[model samples]
Target: MSQKSLEEQIQQLDEQLSSSVEHQEREAKFAVEANERFARNIACFEKYYPQIATAISEYKVREDFCIHVTTTGVGNFVPKNHHAPIYGDDPISQVSAQVEYGIQHPTFSATDYTASPILEDDKRIHIRYMGALTKAFQEIQAEQKERLTVLPEHFPSAMIFGIGLGYHIDLLLEKTSFDYCFLIEPDFEVFFASLFCTDWFSIIEKVDERGGSLFFQLGADEQTFIQDLETLADDIGAFSVVRSFCYQHTPLPEIIELIQQWSSQYFRFQYGHGFFNDAITGLAHTVHLVEKNTPVLTLPKQKRVDLSTPIFIVGNGPSLDEAEEFIRENADKAIIFAAGTAIASLSKKGIDCDFHILVERPYYNYKVFGDFLPPEEYKKTNLIGLNTLYPDTTDRYKWSGVAGKGNEAGTFLLEVVSQTLNNKGIPLMPYCNPVVANTALSFAMFSGFKNIYLFGIDNGNLPTGEHHSKDSIYRNNLDDENEEGLVCMGMNGKYLPANFGGQVESNDLFMGAHFQLEKLIAHYPNRTVYNIGNGAKLKGAHPVRAEELLPLPEANRDINEQVEFLKSDFFEQFNLEEFDDTLLGVKAFNEICDHVLGLAKEPVSSVKEASDNLLRQARYVYAIRNTALHHLHHMIKGALLYYHCPMLSLLYTYTDEQFTLESYAKVNTLWQGYIIEMKEYYQHNYRTKCDHGKD
Candidate 1:
């Protein structure tokens, strides 16, 4: 019972395990008996499980492989129907028809034989069992425990790579509080066999009825799985929700390895996309904050048509060349919404869009409008511009309607300034990226366009040295230099053509923007997004040729009349108030700064709690303004809450406590300074507005 004696006994037992000759002989006899039992068990299974046996016999079984009994009484589909030197050059003629038929270029290590066999109808049905049924159960339990250690900190959700016989999946569901499980098995026969071999249908239905769901993805390749997984992630709300993954080893271990790799890359891609989008929103807010004096125009929130109406969103991809004539001929049939530089490209083709969307704040946007046409001439076409856009472009035409990002800063700033001016952030669309194409799509979807068509919205770029259409502003910079590791899912779901110096490469930004669009559209089940871009297919968006759609009759009114209608609508309910209440505005700003700054200074014990409080405060601030900064406020609060889930580091290794301790220090400091600066900005602006009103 002494500690030292127990340690010595354990060491002695360990040595005895390696040194006992009688034990070795007994194990040798056990192996011989197990193998014999395995051979008999195969015959027994063929007799008892006649359905499976008959199915297997029906196939033209390859000559190289046949059933072989292992030391643990398990039958293996051997490469040569017997033991063969694994390192030898002899070809493996075939593998298990049921399990290995769909597996391409399968790779597995040589089998290791060790433990005794327990007979259950001679003990051959469980081919992976290495010992007695009880011993195998213990080993599986231990392995499951080890694997479960990797589960995220909360209720688990699982994705099992191979649902072998449904045993592991059933056990996993029973053990974990997983609300959903995705079963991905490429071999249809194995899945089908399991249906008959086990009570899989009942178990799946039971889980479904219990408020947990089991998604069966049978006969899917790695590519299809990736696409489906992203769609599922979006359906479930977030990529981070699926915390546990089970990979059952088979003859095709490499495929499982690739699945693991792709899953990791997919998560990283989501994180990067989210981070980049936040940065852009932050940049836009900073610009809005800096240029408070810029003329802000209110956009009209008119419901021109019902959700059943079709809206064609045009972009500046090279594919526009193919759809140009079709769009021009049928421009009046559907409301044409042109994206950023697409306006120029469409205009050059003699196609006029009903509403042109512009979101980027860069000077490059100005180049989209040809120098030949002055601001007055360009006013013939109605425009929708985000307030963050370059001043020259947003202020260019009288027909253009300027809208602010529905964000906290935009709404707050607008509220303080809009008390005197006819300015308020209008909800453009629910979108992650502020890209023109995404914005335009959001506009259509928000306006209840049930049928949406995308033209030249190439998620993938053209061949190298050819990115945009000839008339687009981006065409000038389409060189091979920017053709870095960009890739998108082509129409066939494989990677887009990557010909180095020959084909155009799509950067992650373009591909990520389109993916966000896919997620956005997934929520609206009744709405459909058809991609007419002859390049990469936008996932969730069906592809259709332009000729298949119906062309509309000529419009009763010309483009000028439409522009006039839009301009009139912009000022119909405009309420322009003079900046007369400067003191009142400053008092409200100071009160808000005090409320948030006080909370920010307090020590936070939990990152989640702190983020929740901050976000709540942000919402309260916006509500105090009593006007919407729809996109802007949401982004600001999201960024505030997302501090713990840093875009640069998404490993989830750091706990809330660790994150909060580290972040609360620097972030709170920045938050304090930012609040003070914003307060000062409001005071200065209020005084300026009051002085202007007096003048």
Candidate 2:
């Protein structure tokens, strides 16, 4: 062999060895950096969100999921069982360009305001004026739509749909600051791969420093994603999500489903915005009832009742006519509950219920008993209702008991007062809202009835548009010219999945009640719930045909004795004099009013400033969440959103600096006036009424 050829061959071998060493060094450095990143992220999650921390700590890496480092030194995620990288050769530049494009064209731009003005003929000062103000601002927003070309530098809230390698999250955060950030990653493996590449610790620290929130919905699929979001919105102020800018990092099918679900049900946040009148009236009624020594429903502390007797929860739906025979035959064999206007239907059928439930707080509810049914019909039946129920309505019954309603200022105040006096507060009835059947179901559940059957509680109208029983007041109102027509504007164009395998027309109120019932049923997993008629298919309830009802053994126990036992088991009377000061909640109420008033009057220089001021108010309200006046947040949140959201839309849509400033000032002024009016009205009317009751 020639000496020159041998030397060349030797040189090539040495170069190969050097290249291998370089590759090993790079791999080692990458491993170290990944370990450091994982540790930091886990630590941050543990501090801020222990649930996420535990999930991440326990999650095992999928066999196919891995981090692929490109030649450009950027990490890309190779999703489950996929060989190809999620990002291209130059992932940094790819994600950078994508985020920049997303910034320019947000997937879900925050322009539309969800809160509709309450059109109820409420004569309260705030309700009357705020409704008019909201309508005016809504008009302004409609006019300024074309000008909403760019998002403000400081966005109020954001929803990041996916986190692939988390590059876009870093880029998005660097470009924009959000008060509330909801990061959702449907794939756990993808998120786990991201922990090695993304500096989540830094991101969390940055958000924390800004006094912002970061909600991580890890491993959430399309099925439960919106419900998760709803739970978060309930925990935080729902108003924060009113106009959130949504960014979809990875266009997955599940993410698309989530987006659609969110769009369809976003209006739910706008519902149940207890205005000042309702809040004050609820408080007054609650206070008056407690003072009258009305029996309150306490949570059951004993084991679940294993009675053979079934609970028949009756409602005035269209199916009532079909279930009449079933209810009549079973009435004597079960403890029957007549929900709301169902008493009229039951009276017509000559089937007396063991208990009659009422939920409405207004005088209209009190008039229902006097106007529709005579004293002989419901006088023998026991009354179970929310604390917000009209006091006079309970007077018609032989016996009555009230349970605390969730998400009401009156309930919160009563709870605090109860806690102050007895060291234990009242138990809030779960999902008792939007309808009377919900209250009846809640009562049945709390009473520990194992076998609860729903009759005529159809949460949707039939295909023929028959909503109520023939004997119901709803049908009676159609004939009586003096009775007002049904004001169901909210339910006019809605539909729901029917129990018997078809879609049925439903309203917002019924839909809400249906969902609430599902949630309540879920809380009692051991209990058996049967929906014995065609209705909106509830998630946790078993649908049964009226004719195919479960045949139970004849009830051996005396029905009257069982009814009295239930009353004694769940009901107690509170001494109002013991906690009169706490019951008023004047201090906390005034504090919240002061904070909101200041926020409304705060000066605004830019759209960002105006938005931030509104968010600041939300933070203030939510920060006092552990206090007795927390429900005040619920009371005012909807009304405040109705006022602020339209104003925000106008500000975001219109680029004219002077015009935006002027518009914000005008709206803010009107909002401030409303808050002031609310404070004064509550003090003069509700507070005075409570004080008088004490005297």
Candidate 3:
């Protein structure tokens, strides 16, 4: 057929779809038939289990959800350990129940990796028919029985596995427990078939809140599954696979090795060196790969013991000067967790650190404290940052102090410190912004500290004229003597000195800061983060102005009036530390540069292996890039949809081929404000001044 004719015919067909009376009648008939068929199916199911008809009728399933054949038995049946296996009560409601559930909230869209063009049309690949799967399941079941021995005698109290349809799960439940299962399937056609399984099945859904998407997604291709496995492995602590999902792609031996490494690392992440640390000798090399270019976390770490211990997270706010005496007096009673920049000031005051965290994100001065210290002190302080942040830090602190992502380290510290001491460090952040306050407070919670007292949290700007603006506290060229003192690094009229932004309101945005602080203070009941001077704004007395917002003495203030705050940083902090239980993680993180710079040296991979590996790693990269794109597809689209972001403007116009994962992460972080803005529309909690392509 001619190209023009082909195009015209397609267009005609599209018109016919919209215009034909016959089509409308057919659609109406189809709808009617579908409703009838569904009614009959429900009737049939009720008939099969008339005794529990009420329970069956009460079974609730979300509307407009597609059911995946894989997740059919999730909620319908209960596992052994669960007590009251209500559908989707929480992820692993009670591990002891025999019933399990699967529920997902998919926000970003995802798809499978591309495969051979020939495979696209293969009837066998579509999985529409189950004869093959039936046979495959039969064989796998026997194998599963053998593998079952490897599993503990007690299966999880309740188990939730994703079933593409009910076939695999239906058969499995027949062999096991059913009264406690709850299924979640994303495909409607598949869901209906499974729901017909008597009173044994309850179906839920995975909805994508970002309008057209779901919070979780399945891999589209073999490559997608591999990538998904890696992501799943990251959180499992120790695991070889995501419980129910299957990967059809046959990975190379090396890729399998990577999987093994992932399993090992996850083991370390959970069981620690007891399982895989010494089994793999290149721990130092792995640590090196992960340490580079990460951000400094403003995370707070405190020991747990006694009923209460005060903590102070010193920020470089001018108020640090006034609070000095109080910190000096109570420094020993509470741990002083210094923000990277304030460590110098705290150190100069002879305040020792029981816990020190560095949220060294590159965008901020991640290495602000790195260069300031002499070589020996490397072992003295604990270095931390967001795992996302550390990808960019230089390899300076290896084997000396622990270098874990703030998110991960924070969770560990919370657990560890909570058991060790009674007193905790008080959070003393300087930024007036709510995000900063929230971040700092979240870190405190994770570090085992409760009952935090707020200090140096001048959420507003520095006093009328005595702010960091006047002198130069934030100069990039800060020396050892300077971390505690100010060194000017300001633009002539950019900040302080009244010329900044040419508006008094700009300088007065501290009110906005206070507004945010107030909101932040409302969230945590266990915390106390109030402005001591009743948020007094200082007049022009610079030095004298510093006294307006220092720490408040507990002996004098009304206990109830102390402001408290809370926020969830779980996704970042917990996810990071969870990886440390495995030495595999350390090996996985090591790079050649890492081994060369610090710690125990390791041999490089063979040149041939490197080349061949890069080829597959390239594939992994493609999967990562595509997955990220899928996750942020809405945001990327919005970047262009709204012309407000210049970076997105440049990014959107770049060649499509150039949009690799490495490039995407960098560019996205570089111009994050626009991206963050787009993400906020999806995740209401996402807020960042510059991350969302604000400019």
- Using lDDT as the measure, the top candidate is 2
Count: clashes, candidate 3 = 123
**Model 1 spans > 4 angstroms off:** 1-310, 332-334, 361-373, 387-395, 402-404, 412-428, 449-451, 462-466, 476-508, 519-528, 546-572, 579-682, 685-695
Per-residue error for 168 in candidate 3, Å, reads 50
Give lDDT tens digits, candidate 3, residues 1-695: 89999999999998887766554564555446445555654664464445334444665554633321112222233322334322343222232232221211111111111111222222321121122323323332333221211211111112222333233443333333211122323223334434433222222111111111111222122223323433433332111111222111122343344334333322121211111111111122223332321222223342223224555666545555656667676655554556555656566666654434444332235344555556555455444333223322334443112223221222233233223332332232322222233345445544445545444444333434333321223543444564554463332232222212222222223433333343334434455433332123322112222244345344332211211111112111222322233422222222311321221111223322222222232223224223312222211222221121221112222223133222333332322333233223322211111121112
What value does the lDDT take at residue 489 in candidate 2? 28
Rank candidates, TM-score, best first.
2, 1, 3
Candidate 2 Cα misplacement greater than 4 A, ranges: 1-26, 63-65, 81-84, 109-121, 301-306, 476-490, 577-588, 628-638, 687-695
Model 3 misses residue 30 by how many Å?
34
lDDT of 2 by residue, 1-695 (tens): 99999999999999888877775676677778888988998998899889878888888875555566665655777777556678897888988998888778775445444255665666656567667676666666666544645556777678888888888888888888888888888888888888888999999999999888888887787557767887888778666676678888877777787777777777676556566667777877887788788988776555333465689899888887878887877677789999987887788888898898888876765764677777876678889989888876778888999999887877887787677667887888777887999899987887677889888888877765677787776633455567743422224668888788777687778878887888789888989999877777888889888888756677888777788788877788786753365546566667778888977777777777787787777677777776655766655665665666566555555667777778678777777887777766655566433221121
Lowest lDDT block of 10, candidate 3: 272-281
Question: Model 2, poorest ten-residue lDDT window?
Answer: 686-695
Candidate 1 global CA lDDT score = 0.50
- Model 3 stretches astray by more than 4 angstroms: 1-307, 363-368, 376-378, 389-439, 469-521, 530-695
Better of 2 and 3 by lDDT: 2
lDDT of 1 by residue, 175-292 (tens): 4434556777776555543432234544655675655555666666754666666556543423223334444434355447646755544533233322213323333433443353
Best candidate (score: TM-score): 2
Count of backbone collisions within predicted model 2 = 0
The local distance difference test score of each candidate is 0.50, 0.75, 0.32
